[model samples]
Target chain A: MSLLEVRNLKHKFRDGTEALRGVSFKVNSGDFIILAGKNGSGKTVLIRHLNGLYIPSEGEIFFEGKPIHKQIKWVRQNIGMVFQDADSQIVSQTVWNDTAFGPENLRLPKADIEKRVSNALLAVGMMELKDHSPHNLSGGEKRKLAIAGILAMDPRIIILDEPFTNLDYTGIIDILGQIVKLHKSGHTIICVTHEIEKVLYHSNRLIIMDRGLIAEDTLPEKGIFNTHKYGITPPMEEREGIEIVRDMTWLK
Target chain B: MAEITVFHFQAGNTLIYRLNTKLKLLLLLIYSFSIYQLSLKGVLFLSAFIFIAVSGTLTKPAGLIRQMKGFIFILILIVAASMTSVTGDPLFTGLPFPTREGLLSGMLAGWRFVMIIILGLIFTTTTRPNQIHAAVGEILKPFPLVNESAIAARMSLTIMFIPILMDMLNEIREARKARYIEGSRNPVKNISTITVPLISGVILRAGETSMAMESRLYSGALPGTKQAVQRKEYLLFAACLVPVVPAFLL
Candidate 1:
């Protein structure tokens, strides 16, 4: 069964600008789906609906056969989202406390919260810096901490929006490694980004949107066409003396 | 760049750092109360002692001193006001300045102000921001009308954002320099260039935080078990209250 299904979804802002125009899609369990588009293409607005952040003006979203709006809390718990700005997402002073904020909100037992926080920090290689304030961390580390905060919630589906923005090369690679790791661990992943070169090789499916509509939805290899037309970078398989290495075996 | 460190909590294994945040807060309250009752000479000596002692423990004592640079002008104004406002037997009759009473009163007031500032610095420097949040939350938990956890979380976020705001200001200044507008004489243009972007950035950040909080299922307050206070914490609290006894007696 599909974990999430959106049918004829449409959203219009209060200012009368249409953000999403009858977008429909299905996300199977444990699938890595990449949503690609240019600025104002409605990539973010669509994912915001998945977590019930925005109510649809038309159509509906279903989580395991039920409408998502009725179960906003459950949808949020199961579908975790890591936003673009790491600093804004981090609300707590220390790394551990920030990671614990989600579980604490769930009112989980202390022992369970502790275990989840430790595991999440360990997964992100941030256990050593758990005591440090999130403000002191580098930009990449802050992004990892944000992901760790989501992982502590033990969500089934993880969504990240423009995770590589304003990051150095090493920072980008670090976040990419975490995304790949999460995908391998059987978490259904949905990432939204205009920059496709770094993450395209790993994502199984690519969905492109343009002018508030889904332009294409297919496998990454077949979805490269008309990408530049929508202001997204098309996949570059090879360049002079340097090849795009899709197999990330070295990262393992 | 290093000035930013003065406002942040410094991690350490010292006795002051290890004390519970609630105990430190109580001690600060008692200390502030006691300062008013103490003799002027005693206040001066105590403030100097704390300034020297805390400076000795810090890795960069200069940072602590640098924090006082902005207050120097205010301190001078306060001293001048006290000196001019009070009249008595002058130290040198030929001079136009006030008498010994004004000098003593100004000195006492200045020392009191410095002492209170030092106490706050000591508290913030030694205690982590989360500890302060937890302490405030715990203290407010008994009140039925308040959402202690939510308030605590907001307080902690505010503390964390201070350094971030400072960093943003520095970045904006540097950007201005890069654009060759740092030396612009027009005050309106100079201020607008920074304030507009800073306010916009803050609003955007706040909106993003609200979305992130909603996605994390943060409704109003986070519910979590509190940490158990040790027997040693009681001892520390009692020790902190010792000075208050003398103040009451005097």
Candidate 2:
């Protein structure tokens, strides 16, 4: 069974802007899916609906065969979102407190909260600086801290919106390593990006959206070549004279 | 700017650091109120005691003095204004300045102001910002209409944002200098260039912050396990009240 199902979902803003028109998709458990599109292509709007941030103007969304609206909180608890701006996502003074913010909202016990926070920080290699101020961290460290905050919630699905935006090359590499690690740990990953070149090699499947509808949904090799038509840049290696080699032997 | 440590909390094992945050908050409030009621002598005694007590916990004693540089100018102004109006025996009997009553009154008033600032520095330096939120939440829990957790969270974010906004202002000032706009004589144009971007940045950041909080499922309060105040904390609270008792009697 699919973990999440969206059926002909549509959304319209109060200002008469049609952001999403009859979008539909299904996400299975343990799948690493990339949602790609250009600016104003409804990629953000579509993911926002999955977590109930925006109500659909029409159609339905289901989680585990049940309607999402009936259990909005549960949907939110299961789907953790890491926003683009790292600084804005930090709502607490210290790293530990900010990471614990999600679990605390769930009203867990003191011991459980501490264990989760410690484990999350350790997973992100931020255990030593747990007591430091989040504002003092570097750009790369801040992004990692944001991911750790979401990890503390222990969600089944992790969504990252423009994770590589405003990051240096080293920062981008750092975040990519973390994302790959999460995918390997059996968390269903859904990353939304207009620049798909950085993450294409890692994603198992690609879903392209254009003008509030799905443009193409297929395997990476086939669908990636069609991304530019919808305003997204395909990977550089796909072009002529750019040799690409990826070993699939390790998977067996 | 480098010397300034706004909202920086020093971790320590001192008596002040170990005390419950709620107790410290109450003590700070009581002490602040008592400052106005106490006589000049009492205020001086309290100021001296606080300085001696908090000195052990401060990492940089000089930083506190550096923060007082702006207030020093106001202190001098108060003394100058008081000297001219006060009537009393003049020093040297011929200089026409330095009246004994004015000198005494000015010193007293200046000391009171300094003492208030010092107490505030001590509170901020020793206590963590999150502890303040927890303390505030615990104190407001009894109010039927109040949502203590949400208010505390807002307070924490506001406090944390101060240093960030200050840094942004500094960056904008530098950017203006880089563009040679800093030397422009027109005040309106210079001010508008900086203010426009700063305000817009703040508004954008505020919207982002709200969305981030909502994504984390922050309804109002931090609903995790609560930490209870210990008996030792109650004892320390009583001990702090001892100093204020004399002010009440007087």
Candidate 3:
């Protein structure tokens, strides 16, 4: 069974705008997916549903063969989401407190929460800054704290929405390295970004959405060239004419 | 309050940092209440003692006091307002400037205010916001008709957002400067030009924050944290009042 299965998911805003028309996909364990599309392409809407952040107006989301809503708490705990804007996602004053938010809300024991928070901070290389105010952190550090907050919940699958937005080149590289490390450590990653050139190589598969529907879902190299047709500037053109998927990274 | 970093938590391993958050909060409330009852000498002695005593734990006292420049201006205003009154005996012949009584009274009031804020700074600086939230929830659990956890969560977020909003306002001002739109001499026009963007930004941020909260499984209830006031915590609490109580009685 797939780790996550979405069938005919549709969402309409209260103002009569259809954000997602009918989207379907399956995420198996250990899949590093890059969900890419142009503006208003339902990429965010789809990921939001997987995390139970939004309820689909129509269709069903099955997590490990169980309906999503029926086990929303489990699904939410399992599918962690790192939002596009890192600042808005910071819910506490201190880094340690922010990392503990999810676990505390989960009502885990005090000892368990502490251990999880420590482990998360350690994973992000932020153990030293754990007690510092979140307000004082650099942009890259804030992004890492957001990831650490999610990691504290110990989710099996992580979803990142526009993770590199507003980041400098160094910030982008810092976050991308963390994401790559998370994937290598066996956490499934579903990342959303128009800036695919930064992380397209790390992704094993690419799912392209357009006009509230999945336009293409295929291997990165096969579907990468077609990104321009869907309004995304192809990474191929941006990488100084580099066509190979393996070389599309800053880590190299 | 706009002096954002002054109130932000700083990492330290002093005695104050190790105190239980709930106990620190209770001590702050108790100490602030006692300040109104303190004589001017008592207030001065207590403030001096605490300032000196907690210097190690306060992390950045000099910076914290430096940001209080705006706050100190208000204190001076209070003193000036007190002096302008005619009820007290004048200190000098020059236009009934400062009355001896007014100066003493104003000094007491100002010191009281500073003592309260300093205590608050110590608490916020040493304690985590989430700890405050959890402590608040635990404290309010016995009250009727109260969503204790929700109130606690709001309190935490409000404290956290103050710095963010200040930063936003600063950025808005900078952007306006960059656009050369800050050339207007009218203060009202200057404020109005920036208010709209700041409000819109806050609204947008609120929407995003709610989404972030939901994604993290915030269900308006915090987990049960261990809040028992230990023996060491009580000793620390008593130790805080050691100098203050003697000053008060004297």
* Residue-level lDDT tens digits of model 2 in B52-109: 7668767776665675564676888888788877888896677777789889888877
Question: Sort by lDDT, best first: what order?
Answer: 3, 1, 2
For model 3, the stretches where C-alpha displacement exceeds 4 angstroms are A237-246, B1-4, B37-40, B68-111, B176-185, B242-250
Higher-ranked by DockQ: 1 or 2: 1
Taking the tens digit of each residue's C-alpha lDDT, what string does model 2 give over A158-187?
999888888888888888889889999989
Clashes of 1: 0
Candidate 2 chain A has its poorest 10 consecutive residues by lDDT at A243-252
Candidate number achieving the greatest TM-score relative to the actual structure = 3
Clashing pairs in 1: none
How well does candidate 2 score on lDDT at residue B183? Answer: 98
* Model 3, residue pairs in steric clash: none
In the order shown, the chain A TM-scores of the predictions are 0.94, 0.93, 0.96
lDDT of 3 by residue, B76-174 (tens): 877777777635678877656678888877777777888887887788788777678779998999999999988988888887776687677778878
DockQ of the candidate models in sequence:
0.47, 0.39, 0.53
Q: Could you tell me the TM-score of chain B in model 1?
A: 0.68
Query: Against the true structure, what is each candidate's TM-score?
Result: 0.84, 0.82, 0.86
lDDT of each: 0.82, 0.81, 0.86
B49: Cα error in model 1, Å = 4.2
Runs with alpha carbons beyond 4 Å of true place in candidate 1: A237-252, B1-10, B33-42, B52-61, B64-118, B179-194, B224-231, B238-250
